[model samples]
Target: MAGKLNILFITADQWRGECLSALGHEMVKTPHLDALAADGVLFKRHYANAVPCGPSRASLHTGMYLQNHRSGTNGTPLDARHTNWAKEAAKLGYDPVLFGYTDTSQDPREEDPESPWLLTYEGPLPGIRPVAMMGTWPTPWTDWLKANGYEVPADIRYAYGERAPGPEYEDGAAVPRPLIYPKEADDTSFLTDRVIDYIAESDKPFIAHLSILRPHPPFVAAEPFNAMYDPEAVPGFKRKTTHDEEAAQHPWLEHQLGRKLFRAPAVEKKLRRMKAVYYGLMSEVDEALGKVFAFLKESGRWDDTLIVFTSDHGEQMGDHWLLGKCGYFDASYRIPLIVRDPRKEADTARGTEIDLFTENVDIMPTMLDLIGAEIPVQCDGASLRPFLEGRAPATWRREAHWEYDFRDPADDSAEKRLNLTLHQCTMNIIRDEKFKYVHFTKLPPLLFDLEKDPDEFTNVANDPAYLPVVLDYAQRLLSWRMNHDEQTLTHISLTEDGPVTRRAARY
Candidate 1:
């Protein structure tokens, strides 16, 4: 009992929880995850704190919401002073090794002589050593191809609507193609190989976060899995209502096609290929995970190691006509979360599915506490150990908090004025069980009833009948902000008339 258990955290980039068979999505076969679920707990109601890579990862690592971290934009980097999970783990005398990235936002002021991004997580916490950082992958696979003389021509760095071969990637190397042996050659497969190797050594109890880069974009899968899922077999998302029927309800989806990028005949073909490739990548990712799991079992560490499976966030696959996560819709925030408590708790494993809402923030503290490490008292996140112990505490919370900042680009001086740009101003979200309230600063807020309109086809934020519901969620949002966010005097300022200020404040 005194010896610490190792932590194997696996995260898939932009992976939807519904894509795997374990989640009842019949199309994709995930035998590896299905068995893992059978042996442990699977969360049925887990949500990401933010959509997209940078901010979502910030929240997950710090156990602080975006409101607190203030690395508000994709390009905005988290303050170097922040505490991260790996740093925390090190404090417990365990080596907290980060196998991949945290997708931390790039800082605005680059080329700093002492760059914060280059440093370790807020200075090591203890027992953890942030090593073997197989820096941002998939891109590296393209690099590996380049190093090997293959002319791959797709920027897997970012993928949006109707993309064609571009400057960075010219040939089909970056495009979807059949690999000789997917299990042995794909990018995800290589990453799994690294993980298995790390675990095999098991020289000491280690905390390894094996983050995967596929299922994100470029949607290209390796080999047989590339043609594995028949687009015909996978049904298109059921349309509850027509898009043209609702004007101004969701214009974001329509603008995503980028008609300029693809000429006449290529649009539909691009869409078909994109979806097929995305699912293929999912299958390939699952195969890699299967190998990792098999190694864990063979090493006899399966029961003792606590495994966590989740993703930074979800992707919007033509949903609402959007290609990626740019809105507060369910397709963007609903991520997969599964916690396999240390095998020592095997017999005591109680419930398999937890319906209560859980946010990515809860993960850090929960993991910290489970491993007998100290959970910071000030963290806004609550440890979920009780739920795993088969005792749903009476005070167990049932909701999650999410926020996005929408800054108005029209304000040129916005960055200097408030220490952030317009992309940093859109603070809005879906909350409670059925209501979504979006506060767009100068713009009108949005409200959606998830229970009544699962498709979010209506904007009830302005409806007087649901005004109370909006206010209730609004106050809860504020409470969440107050608990998580931290602002400094420099971040705010006083205006001539009164004390008008510009800063990132939670409440």
Candidate 2:
């Protein structure tokens, strides 16, 4: 409290909360995060608003539920008319900064004056400047290598195992193990080095978000970690074969690309190796992050800094026979979240974990609350500070929410659309302490009693006995949409000075 506070926001691309040792995953070691948790608070049941980068981040940075600001996928651009945290932070005299890219794409309607989604697509929210907007993850790695005098391959990506002499698929190497220091330097290490350097010189009340890429595909790790775990050592996904088998129910996963791409044939052995490498990559991130935290502690800035650790979303790994996150399942939507308040409270619940439902969408509001900034009235998430400090608002929803838009027909031909047009096969999920409801727009809905089907092996949505349960969830889902939709259903008036103007419903 002696100086202007610093906010260290660390976000990984697709990290699973269960992957951390602190969370009971014995495979990975996150000592620094563990240490921070010792002095901070960890949320055991946090989820993501959406999966696969863009949409998820849109919700995170904007503090809005997916329904309110629907950028539903990676290619969809968020509408810029809304407000974002960094923009508001700037008004508070703090120079909010971003270290990595915000996958938020430009709304096509705005980009192309004639695009259909234009009236439909939301644009970027205002505020926050990316101090370092390395176009994509590759740009950051390449830049770091060059700056450090390391020669990086222009062909930045390579597959782990060769698939004969074909066009190189971005899938990573076949070998999975512990972290191996590169002949020069690893991307994970390099990015962290840059982050450490930036924090060292930063004198402002910095709000830095370090977005890491790893354990994502390209499952390659530096070394040592490259060959870390034995397949058997890493737990097998609870439902693999059944998952892909079920994919037939969903069009996107059944498409040619989805089918052909992955470590398939259920290579249990290879998967273990892949997971080992994934863990190795994770450790590398942990090591890099530890340095940043250590520096803060050593510089005596630790007390004034608030650090939050979470991922944009969770990866499916081999869960439900899927690779990466693109579904409405737990592996794809559930993420990890830890908030380390710099005050370092006494009775400081070190390694303290809360099971209350939480999600990345709540992140911005939490940060705003800590900085004493005004959270926009339109925000959907409640501040996490209350839960982190062991307080839960009575109004908090017992169930966490997540959404998925079926693929746009033009791009990949999915069935979630009304008639297979530009829209996607949409699925909405509402997860509570024990039950989960996954409602696909036109497809068979899925329901699970998490208490019994923790792995989600049983789909009860079709069971007659569970019809009532399904109805309850469906109603909730509908209510959620009605409360948060763009208000496209009704005609309202907007006043310029006195009142405004009125418009009729177009759609």
Per-residue lDDT of model 1, residues 271-330, tens digit only: 555677788788788778888888888888877788889998887676655567765777
Per-candidate TM equals 0.80, 0.84
Q: Model 2 reaches what TM-score against the true structure?
A: 0.84
Error of 1 at 197 (Å): 1.1
Cα displacement (angstroms), candidate 1, residue 84, comes to 1.5
Q: Cα deviation of 207 in candidate 1 (Å)? A: 0.7
Question: Which stretches of model 2 miss by more than 4 angstroms?
Answer: 1-3, 108-126, 135-137, 147-149, 157-184, 240-258, 262-265, 344-351, 416-421, 486-507
**Which candidate should be chosen as best, given lDDT against the real structure?**
2
* Tens-digit per-residue lDDT, 111-226, candidate 2: 66875335432233346566654423356666666776765555654322112232211234444433323623665666666777777887677877776776676676665566
